[model samples]
Target: MKGKLLIFLIILILTTVPAIGADISGNVISESGKLAGLIVDLSKINGTESDENSITGVTYDFIPVASTVTGYEGEFVFENLDNGEYRVNVTYEGVTSGENIRLQDDTFVEFNLSGTIDGYVFKYNSTIDGVPVYLYDFYGIPAGNTTSGNNGTYSFGNIAAGKNYFVSAVYAEVSYTNNVTAPASSDFIVYDTTDKSDNIGVTIDHIVLSKDANSILVYEYIQFINNGDRVFFSPERTWLAIPTPRDISNFQTDVMECCLEREEDTAWIDPMIPLMPGETYSTEISYRFNPTSEPVFFNRITMYNTDYISILSEKINGLGLESTFSESNIVNVNDKEFEVLDFMNIPAGMTPDVKITGFVPSKNTGSDLGILLPLLLLLSAGALSYPFVRKKMLLKKKKVFTVKYNPDNPSGENGVPSGGNSEITALGINAENHTSGKTVEEMSFHELLAERNNLFESIMGLENEFNSGNVSEQEYMAQKKERRDSAVLVIKQLKDTATNLDLTQPVPELEEVIRHIDDIDILEKLFEREEKGMDRNEVKELIEDRIEDIERSE
Candidate 1:
């Protein structure tokens, strides 16, 4: 009778209690119908808050409750979810969509995914058929390719929505490209092959020469100008033929590999895209060669009429040109000086000879007699005095020493073994010395602001130098990275210090700093800092606007 009564009581309790929670369901659908195996995130709305000064205005605080993947029918569910405000987010092919709702009982949500690209290829004004069309993502990754249909139409489906893409078509051996967004149409108008022109000439030929240990490195920046009324196209695709040394090594060009070809002593610039009339295009080439004689002679034929030519050589101890072609001038580049030789109005097919004199090999000190003689003498003297030095030390009385610790003078001023506060530490640095005069932890907020400002100025100056062609690409990139990294560290320190001081008001120093920051990465860091460090909504908005401006410019 007791067991039966207990069973009856348990059944009564189970029937009286309500269900655990409600159910949240959703589905993802695209043009293809339904997307299966898509991950859906369900987050409960913990709360909502507003920041009047923030660019985002009001923001929602979410607590992730559960996650599920869509089934074969692109449907997902969160069972036993308590009645409350919730959010459902689904991501497909790099595109994300979300929806929020207040769950009273069972709820359903739907997501529509759109990603389709379609376009047509045209020659002049008429649609062209059988032209090969290619699609590439914003990152230059080839997404798909197909030939245009009889109607000259092309279509790509199921690509990521809200993403940038590139559409290109090749016609008559020339490639035409255009940028497009998903769910949009892009049309390409290509021009047919034209006759080659003799009006193509070189506007500027700037050569920069620097020397390595035994080889001379050369960088050539050539600008080609088409003076014809029609596009300059050659049957062989040879736009310009540049003369190069026979023994040149590590030859490289800025153009595509297909646009450049080399034969014995000549590098051909065969650009696939024809040069438009009254337009100029710049090309860069670099190579290195070893000198075989005291005065090296560089003889090269000009393929086109050269308007102006300038050669700049690095200032080395034994490196100079034999004669100045025109008015020679010394120019400073990247804190180093270069000797410039200028010439103007050289006709085509003229072979200009440049003689480089004073080719002195760098001296090696490993076989120097002076260094070896002194080293041998010092060794001999140390060996001859070893016995006498040992005997005298043995006769001398030993002195014992002890270190005394003094709280008043802890740096060994009071006969204590110095803790090496002024000496090199294990990390190969002086404990009490720093290049910035104070350690990062010891720097004041104002000092950090000043440092950041200086770094910004340095970056700006570096960009100017790079733009002026005074700095090499490799060097400019390396220095820019290092300076930007330092600036980021300083900015982080400023953020932490500001937060600790509870800086809620606008600061002129910080505002000035933000106004000067052009780097997108640094601006982002400052944006994050504004959330917790200083409550400057205007500054945040300023940064946002600047970032947008930069993006547009790019």
Candidate 2:
């Protein structure tokens, strides 16, 4: 009797349990594949008995403990539930038109949920991770979430086949670029696998919106495809500089009703709705971000308002909301992903700090290497390696005595060399090419002044002889003129030397009849005494005598 009772108990437990904890993957579709991310409200569904207290027209999934499933890429599933017969009413947020329909049971069923679909949850203008995704029915409420991976993919597990729901992809604690106030939109919707759908099959496509994303002012879409697949996954991601913050102010969506309220367009409604597979639609949420005047602040990431709505003119059901997406992804500055802990608020003054480094290029870091290395290296290597060969190359290759200096060639000593052919070769010592340039070692200013004194002396002698009447008037004038010219030339040279020595300082005047061979005027005036006895030689002698006297005094 004990054995029999035990067997009976085991059978009863087996028979009574509707879902064996095995994921019964179901699709919401018309003729397409899977329908993901649409909220099926328990109370409000069109064509299903929702106004009445009973959901009898549609399938009821009475799990020992009832649970909800979400869709991603047009796929959904309910896991870890002991299934039983429970009434389910499918309501997509704004989508209601579907061809195929399914009757509800506890097990996996493949029937028309509406239009078929494959869906994904892309962060609306974000590269952050670990954002929570939500789904909604015709009325606004939470549905399911897609756990986004590093690759920005999330999945909705088992779903009620005919349930129609709308999707809202949310990224928590995501950043907004500074000073940019525009709506960046990403989509999570129900999709169908058919020729008429936008996205289908395992590969679901989505546009990732970021802080710098410039979305069109009109609308942005989330596509769905119902391709008859089960629990297809997509990834999601978020980003933060600090530990994730709980400030939800940065993440808010405003809904505005269009003037045309004829259909599933209404106020206080999330535009996401009953997404058929292979069908694409977009809803506008006022995504204007208000910035703070804080410097180097942080963005606190979190999921908010999981429920949204889309209504009609009088009162019609379209889609709903859900939150089943996994909070596991987050994005950083490098766009690298890390596992997120939770949706919490991060504080300000937490941006990554990068030092403003003034790297004066070091010799090792490729700075002055261009100016210093190669020449030094070449010179050093030349001196160190093969010094003998280098010397040989210098002596032999530099043309030691290019033939021999031909003395027959007219030496340009007193006369300047005038023609290009004059220089065939150099004798004694030729100037060596110097990178530093040709510079005379030493030339004293005093030595140069001494040379000028001698010249002035000769001019003074000529002037003296002329003044003494030793030469005829014409002879005196001519002699004085020559001496004057000589004195002028010498004085000009002195002026040039003085200028080179920067001797332009103020000098006191001398009074005592000092004979100065300053210029032609000085010499001529001294000799123009109206005398014919004075000659050029006698005047020159006088100048020489005056010069000695002047030098002795100095």
Candidate 3:
């Protein structure tokens, strides 16, 4: 009876335990025939969940189970997988194909190979070797990357057929992009580099002065134009120096503190990027100082050959202003009247000066004569020294302005508070940080791209404000750096996520639907399909082209 019971227990244990012999088999083939020597990967689908908030809308967890190389007949298999869902992937060169299966029993899968792409990089009519080339799918996702060969030629294999892709080549820190279909050729044209500053000139030099209580705020806009054909590439980091008054205070510019080096009476600014030909680059500088007495003189020395230098100062009721420039007029800006001074064709190292005088106390105080009798008598007795006494009193009562950086509130015109307080909210240094309240790692590829474009527009708008002399240099530089840094972070994340995407999975047949559609509304719906597996460059391009053609035909 004991032997029989032990034998029965052993039989029950064997029956209850599940078998782990379910196999998954696959073959890699092309239109020609089955191909061999391909890397195949098998993964188990551990779980899956829906993510409505995600651009992909679905999340999958894959556990790598096994890997093998295809045999002579392009056959591969995983023999010991459990009875569960599995995926088979095969990659040859840069192309990938994959399929999923429910492995209740043995399963068989097949993969079709794709096409290839080749390109070249040229600079100054000559091919350049060792340039880095990047490949991006239609959805602006990075697919692969390689460097140019010794002959300046580059190629990528296994690209999906009948699909459009973008190829970007980076040479001398500049990137050139071209769109092409698979099984096609593309080339890049880049310019040679130069560090010569002879061709650089100031197209517009504008100065704006506004009265903030007793202090005078000065803003300078300098737009540099490159007239040369070659890009201005400075290995040692080029600098443009602007000479300011020696007594100026609160000096600031649209660059980091390290880049905007101040010494005695000169503010040196480093425009970060390489100045391309026919492009206009701008820099802004601002400072504040108290006028000590009548005929206060403001001086600035030009660093480049300036085409036009215009100085605009807000008109004070009792104060008179004069400029060394003979061309003067009165203009209205933003509902405020200003005294304008124009200096044209100023040579480098030439100085422009402005003088302010007639500093008389306002007589419209509405105070009774009895209250002002003592003050009038004292001012008459010291008429020659009245200006000095008034300046001294103004300095004594002047409030020290404290600049506070706030990422949320960036709408101030010139970062000056209207209230009679010492604190002012300046441009945010990390405005992008608070924009979406999401870190770069947490953002999806679509979100990252959108953020990148927004940051770019913000930077451009900041530069425009600086050029218009509407914003202080401190604010422009702070916000520009923050936005640029955020954009860089987002771009890096986008590249990483794009390169890691499962390109082996089948893309939806979006091209067919897009080709048959000619309405703008249909094109928009095509973009909405990005959440589905239909997101591809071919679909986007076809939709855009069709819409344009339809609009033209209409």
Best by TM-score: 3
lDDT of 1 by residue, 73-190 (tens): 9999999888878877776665445666678888888766677778888776788899998876543435677888887898877666766666778877666666676878988776
TM-score of each: 0.39, 0.16, 0.46
Flag clash pairs in model 1: none
Clashes of 2: 144
Off by over 4 Å in 1: 1-120, 125-161, 173-175, 193-204, 210-240, 245-264, 268-297, 305-308, 322-325, 344-347, 352-554
Name the lDDT of candidate 2.
Answer: 0.29
Kindly list the per-residue Cα lDDT of model 2 for residues 216-254, writing each as its tens digit: 011111122333322122222111011122211222122
Query: Clash totals for all models, in order?
Result: 0, 144, 1
**Alpha-carbon deviation at 354 in model 2, angstroms:** 53
The best candidate by lDDT is 1
Model 1 earns a TM-score of: 0.39
